[model samples]
Target: MQIQVKDISKIYGTGENRVVALNSAAMTIHEGDFISIMGPSGSGKSTLLHIISGLDAPTSGQVLYGDTDIHKGNDKELSAFRRQKMGFIFQQFNLLPVLSARENILMPLLLDKRQPDETYLREMTGFLGIDTRLTHLPHELSGGQQQRVAIARALIAKPAIIFATSQRAILTAKAAAKW
Candidate 1:
């Protein structure tokens, strides 16, 4: 899938309290592309990702995935689109505390009513170096280990695109190389 991010902007609040998070930002992302948005803190990197990925709406303009304007879709349609076509690795590890690493990794598949492919699951976890920690809960893992689990979870379904914020922040160079 190719992504086109047109002249999108995100504004918060109004009057004196208003903050412009994004302004006329535009870009194009094609399949198999590894693009990174870089800026100092509070420069709308996350905001751009949210708008482009349909997690949040832009104050003006649009984000399109091929011919479909993703932001124009209703909540349910957008949710399904995100689930089936995109993967996300949030800056904060969003692992469920009650679930084991394995369960967290399998959550997306379960949500889609699809069964896990054991071979792919095993290889993915192994590649991310979380295979031995699968049965453990998030709290039982180290910060890096938690990040690895999150990364594995994002990639388990092999979606067409992945949106990640600071995805390598917690990982070492060696660990990131495995990604």
Candidate 2:
């Protein structure tokens, strides 16, 4: 499996205010596999994604990417792992209001001190049907268009796993299937 999570558990707070975010949760995802996690509020979907992406550590159990234990890695290592191997899509289209679509899409590559891959960037913009809107700011676009820009940004890195929240499920499903 490309991703394996075992006996994972997460608890928030303690004593009377304790909340179990995840309870002995386990799952496996193979390469090129597509899956959906559907549930009502407070069902641990976000927490599971966070743990798998190495954004948050579980209170107990382990998250493995291939044979490596992600939780065992230090913060800098985990940050690099996440930057190079994972893509996250939140419900809120998290785009910088001041930047144009192209700039926003290129932000990750810029941050990693790498030049933008023009061909890939173009392909991503084309795939998301936002090529013409590349020069536009976030506030200038409609909700769906803004979401498409965010999707392009996420795909620009070509990560192994794309973790998406519920609101972006439709776009995420489409992008995952396309890739």
- On TM-score, the leading prediction is 2
For model 1, residues 1-179, the per-residue Cα lDDT tens digits are 78898999899999999999998999989887889888776899888888888878999998889899998879999988888788888778999999999999988899888899999999989988999999999999999999999998888888889988774455666587898
* Clash pairs, model 2 backbone: none
Q: Output candidate 1 Cα RMSD.
A: 5.0
Give lDDT per model, in order. 0.89, 0.86
Worst 10 residues of 2 by lDDT: 163-172
Q: Return the TM-score for each candidate structure.
A: 0.86, 0.86
Stretches > 4 Å off in candidate 1: 167-179
Error of 1 at 126 (Å): 1.3
Please state every model's RMSD to the true fold in angstroms.
5.0, 6.1
Q: Clashing residue pairs, candidate 1?
A: none
The candidate that achieves the highest lDDT relative to the unseen native structure = 1
